[model samples]
Target: MELGQASAINFGDAVAAPQSGRRAQEPAADATADPGVIETSIPFRLDDLRWSGFHTRVVLALGITWVLDGLEVTLAGALSGALKASPTLRFSNLDVGLANSAYLFGAVLGALGFGWLTDRIGRRKLFFITLALYLTATAATALSWNVASYALFRFLTGAGIGGEYTAINSTIQELVPARYRGWTDLLINGSFWLGAAIGAGSAIVLLDPAVAGPDLGWRIAYGTGACLGLIVLVMRMWIPESPRWLMVHGHPDEAHAIVAEIERSATGHDRAQRAGTLPKIRLRMRDHTPLSEVVHTLFVTYRERALVGLTLMIAQAFFYNAIFFTFALVLTDFYHIPSDHVGWYILPFAAGNFLGPLLLGRLFDTLGRRTMITFTYGVSGVLLALTGYLFSIGVLDARTQTIAWMVIFFFASPAASAAYLTVSENFPLEVRALAIAVFYAVGTGIGGVAGPALFGALLDSGSRVSVFAGYLFGALLMVIAAVVASRYAVAAERKSLESVARPLATME
Candidate 1:
């Protein structure tokens, strides 16, 4: 075993050797024991990704997905006033709900469909295909001639959006360092809503016509979103392949190549030490395995992990879908804010959105997964329900509205990022992408369809105040999700991804 570099591990001096096959925590781990002899804090080939960098890319990608999603859905929000006022569109509250939901119903199909695509094909390759498809979908959304036509186009767009939730999250977790994974993933996830704020904010600004005649604001907003997605296609080129996936799927050489490049990135930086330290370093490359074996590893032995992904995804999509679809309507109809100032009011949501990952992410590790996520779900729900109720009761003055909105935004923040971290950490390298996609796709798809259906009914039949109570139910779902998470969710950050093992999962 080669040793004695300044960062090298000293076998005799280090703690008990790490067990075999435990995944590397961070590439920045001070030293490594060979995988055959020990497992904790092993090194990865690439070092530049700083787990944070990996998260940054994921956040950026999801941000685009979320922006496009917000854009696609906002067709309903942005044009609602017009649709409601115009006799031609003949829109009703129920119609609006169904239109909002149609996209989500399509997303349900999209998530499952794309999950299969990610699993069968490859994560990195599938990203471009999904993005391009969504961009085309977004552009086409601007051309809808009727409610049914609009709903059909939106549904297709939802599918592409579904692909984004699953694929980008899976890729980021596979590529980033473990130390900062939670923090970064949460930050990235929060940016999805920030993208939403962008979508709506842009809609607010672009509502005026450039050439006079009819107001082309909503269409222009969709166009801007589509163009931004095209820009995303170009930006994604810079990101490298997943080192973990390369290592697990018969690409050890490629994995090492990525590892070496990352190592070069680490040459000048300070190394992050592991808790209780380990033995001297030895570089031993791992055995290559077929994709079939990887697939079996996840579905067969790691079903519990899959459940975690699936359940949490459900919670995230349910709450998020409900909030995003309804909030704009709530602001305009219940509060009666002028359409122009609505976007400015939502800009603060960006603040709450950005804050979740940057600040609350630390609690995932510090407070531990069970405690933090449970609290996150509980608190966010309470706050959101209150925000809804406050808006309904006229208790929120303008300043108070922003404050309450900020609070509610903070509540919405954690699930987006926190859940991704959970999904990624729960599965092994071979099927990391697949697990993430399945989890998000199913959750979002299910939630997307159900949330709007329920809310739309409330929006149509009764006092507008009842709609906030419906939001309360959505928040309550998070509490249930928290229970599921507490019972089923394993602590991924405390351990390495490779260390994951279910009750019946004995390694060969």
Candidate 2:
């Protein structure tokens, strides 16, 4: 299918037909008709297409990043005992906590640096770069000879995964249809639990003295993620760059071709003929958005949305990181649960986390974003407070404690996933990736970085009261974020990206 010939439409005018024939080459730096100022229906056509195998491929390939992150985190938590027992580098409770913090700190820096580049460059390029870093760093984690070495490798691994969040979330939001965006993003983010489950299961066998021994088992676990990263690299080659991104970045012809190809693959024919009736958006193409514009867009133009995003991200970061990073420590220190058996407890917890999104994610699209986000966050906070109280009073045993956590996280998982969803979709296209990175970095730095260390110190005290205090703090943050979301969160359900937040480069 050919794009209709370029028409003499005025600036800000909507061209009813697909922009004419493909240019022999990309537009010159100053050219307007060939690329710069052409109006196109790419976004509308993309959102209108039916889901197909192509969408499935994209989900499987890009969605795997969360799984890798989950695996890394769970291994860190579950391997706390093995690290302490290792002859080469025996770790204290504080050492384990510090390592986890190092990873989060790395993620903070990675998100900021790569997120800026994702916006300046393109999504497709960053995917490989981040994955390669993750693969190399995780493998190196297996070779660490000391606590400092281990922390450094974990930090690098965190950076890779952190970068993955910006690029993958941005691409997913841009590629998915508006109707499916909420559930798809939540489920993909929630897939982190699937990795958690995998890590838990691996720990059950790998950490067993008879199977692999303490040191060998943990090392192998880190190596597993590296192997998985290699597979992910191959799978990503088939995915294309975001057409919405291309459209506003002076590649309308390439954008048109990609949309047309997606149409043929998804519908078995070019849908460009029907595009004449679809709505068109005019964009002034540019090489990149200036940092000053991005700052203004987030703080001045969309300040309220920025506040909501930061609150959600900060709350979830603390709630998840504080508890999850030190899960095995609590089990071993308080209840005398063996290190190898901690995975059994995690499996149930991971199940609850994953199922929450799978079951409730559709509601974000149906019941609406504000209403659902408020409900999930409130429920999770209340449950955590109650659970923390029970544990403080010595009323819960190892089995019962895990059961309580399973129930609490069932609500919290989707709540956490929604934080990412909120930040990624609420910003304009040009700064979308960087905005996510900034919120994640700030939130993680403030809430995530210190959580595990704080909790680790609490656990070391052996005072249930001290631990309960930490839980209460996290619960409070969640409750506050829920209230803020109810009052200010965007009701962005089932809306196109352009409608939710217009592109910064839009002509009119």
Output the worst ten-in-a-row residue range by lDDT, candidate 1.
Answer: 39-48
How do the predictions measure up, each by TM-score?
A: 0.79, 0.94
Judged by lDDT against the true structure, how good is candidate 2?
A: 0.90
lDDT per residue for candidate 1 within 49-113, as digits (tens), equals: 34445445545754566656655665456556545544346667667778888888777677667
Question: What is the RMSD of candidate 1?
Answer: 7.1
Error of 2 at 6 (Å): 16
In model 1, state the lDDT of residue 444.
66
Mind sharing the TM-score for model 1? 0.79
lDDT of candidates 1 onward, in order: 0.63, 0.90
Best by lDDT: 2
TM-score of 2: 0.94
**Model 2 lDDT per residue over 1-508, tens place:** 1232333332212322234433333323424453345567778888887788888889999999999999999999999989999997899999999999999999999999999999988999999999999999999999999999999999999999999999999999999888899999999999999999999998998999999977799999889999999999999998999988887877666677787788888889867667766776767677799999999999999999999999999999999999999999999999999999999999999999999999999999999999999999999999999999999999999999999998999999999999999999999999999999999999999999999999999998999999999999999999999999999999999889888898987775
